[model samples]
Target: MTVKEGMGEEPERYRVEFASGTAASVAKRRSFRDLERNDIERDLPGWPAQPPFKVRGFFGKLGVHVLSATTGLLMLPLYILAEALGSPASPEKRGELEERENEIDDFPVMWAGEGETARTLPWQLDPSRRSWRTVTEIELAEQDGLVRIWSYEDTGRGSRHLSWGGGEKVPGSEAVLWSMPRSEITSAEIKRFSMAESDFTVSFRDGSWARLTSSPHGARRIVALLGQGVPEGCHPA
Candidate 1:
């Protein structure tokens, strides 16, 4: 009994196929594409508007502005101090300190570097104020072809001086090897006094420097770089 007049074709039948005898059934077909697009507009309610600004009186706004300005002003000094401390030394400061230093042709001067400044011992005194007149002299001696001496004092103004060649060994004076300021002094290498003499150089604050040698010539060159007498040449590099 086969009937095919009104029906198009018998509904298609499917059979499961498994490799390991595992049972399988037809899976339900589901899709959420349309629902996902419409969910927010259809199901979610609209939120009301929020206040434009904080709920406060006019005085409150003024107070907030004033407080902010005051806080910023208070921090300014602290920031400046931190910067000054952290920074090494500026050319201006180095120049000022160099101007304060003095150089002489007879003695070796020693100074300490202090944050773009140099410090000397036995500070100078006013010459005009002194009732008694005094003269200070420095001496240097050649020992084993190398300059060496003991630092001594003399009767004079507390002025500092750099010295080098002299004839006699004075009692009140000592021999010193003029050295560069520790701050500007980049490197100190021990080399043959004559072989690598050009390796030595003395720097100044104003970006100026002088080539030096291991002999007394180096000492003289450093004194010149320091600008012991030229007030304007004391600037730092």
Candidate 2:
């Protein structure tokens, strides 16, 4: 592969290695111009399509930011008031945040919500404190011989608008936050349920498990897709 240089800049070189243990789709560059194209590299046929993050290119993003900044300034006092008046994260939760910040900080980590139904919050909340009210993207990809689930912060910095838009762009800087290899994952199925959301467990080969909470519809769907994948850890103490 060759990189182009024209603006008195030195050419940079790089290499990407794929582990044969996993499935991958490879497309060779037809021309040096191929480098200019910014498209998703891995194209999984059966996987879900990416969510939309529309704003256009640089100017479009700039305009949105300017508008948001203007609006945000007006809303600043309300934001400050909300911070003062609204309930804050409990000391324990704050401690947990700091403790796990190193482990996971790009995307919001799981947590209970406010009020009586605290423990029953969605597996991923609408406006998460961890994500600073920004939407975090959950994605599945085949890598390192396993199909893995990944979360990208603020949807890969896709759409920065305040509300009503989302999607991830795998900005290279995006970190793989939460995921376990498919080989290690025994199953991901709902273990408990309520009217609003269902709590599911992701069992592993070692009989260890992680719990996930999702909407009722989403819960069954997730299990249907991943529950039967070499299921084994039925009893994880």
Candidate 3:
């Protein structure tokens, strides 16, 4: 596999190719950590959320320290055991394990020409109060003469698990966000911002529009997808 980052007008664009004759143009986005932090700060308005101050008084502070130490000591054995057993396998290996465990083989692998794979990007719907509570993973793929915007919502239990015990569960199920023919995309633009942030907007013939505040790489992927003249598969709408 080879990954190369691009520069110039679009800094987030990337091209990744595998030995299997599969290639993809990906746009890098902001880190999930930064997105989470921005989400939290957006909710508190002018006040930024900070870690709670330690309890006042010597005994209270001492008690907190003792509890933390005790917890760390209790977990030492497990840590040693994990180290002895060696680190977990790579994500790809783990994925293979999961597939074998579930007896499944048709799962879609990103950046691979498995199905109608294109560029997968992440966007926050409502960053103000949402934080990292939910994620909208969108994939832009071409099928027939149309471009399908596949949106997967990860909420509730599906949300990312954190060590801080802050995560939402899987809400229900995933659904299609929207779909439009290649010609129906009347206009498209990338709105750049500071701190390597950017937004992508696509206007449909019906006067409706969809906007995604994603990384520059993501915006470029949408642009690239729109520029593709050939449709991968034959299907209506």
Which candidate number maximizes lDDT? 3
Each candidate's TM vs. the true structure?
0.17, 0.34, 0.33
Ordered list by TM-score, greatest first: 2, 3, 1
Error of 1 at 46 (Å): 81
The residue-level lDDT of candidate 2 at 54 comes to 24
- Rank the models by lDDT, top first: 3, 2, 1
lDDT of 1 by residue, 1-237 (tens): 112223453221111000010001101110001111111111112322222212224575466557656966786777677778995432111011111111111111222232221221111111121222222111222122221212334444434333332324347454342323334433222112212222233333433332222233443443433233323333222
lDDT of 2 by residue, 1-237 (tens): 123334654232111111010001101101000112222212322223433212235665466557656866787777677679884322111111221211121111121112111122222222212343333333333333343333344443333234444554436634433444556655665442122334344455554333444445555555564564325423311
Off by over 4 Å in 1: 1-117, 120-150, 153-167, 170-184, 187-237
Per-residue error for 221 in candidate 2, Å, reads 2.6
Error (Å) of candidate 1 at residue 230 is 17
lDDT of 3 by residue, 125-189 (tens): 32322344444443443334555433333444433334344344455645544345567665655
Which pairs clash (backbone N, Cα, C closer than 3 Å) in model 2?
none
- CA lDDT of each candidate? 0.26, 0.34, 0.34
Which pairs in model 3 have colliding backbones? 27-217, 155-169, 156-168, 156-169, 156-170, 157-169, 157-170, 158-169, 158-170
By lDDT, the better pick of 1 and 3 is 3
TM-score of model 1 relative to the true fold?
A: 0.17
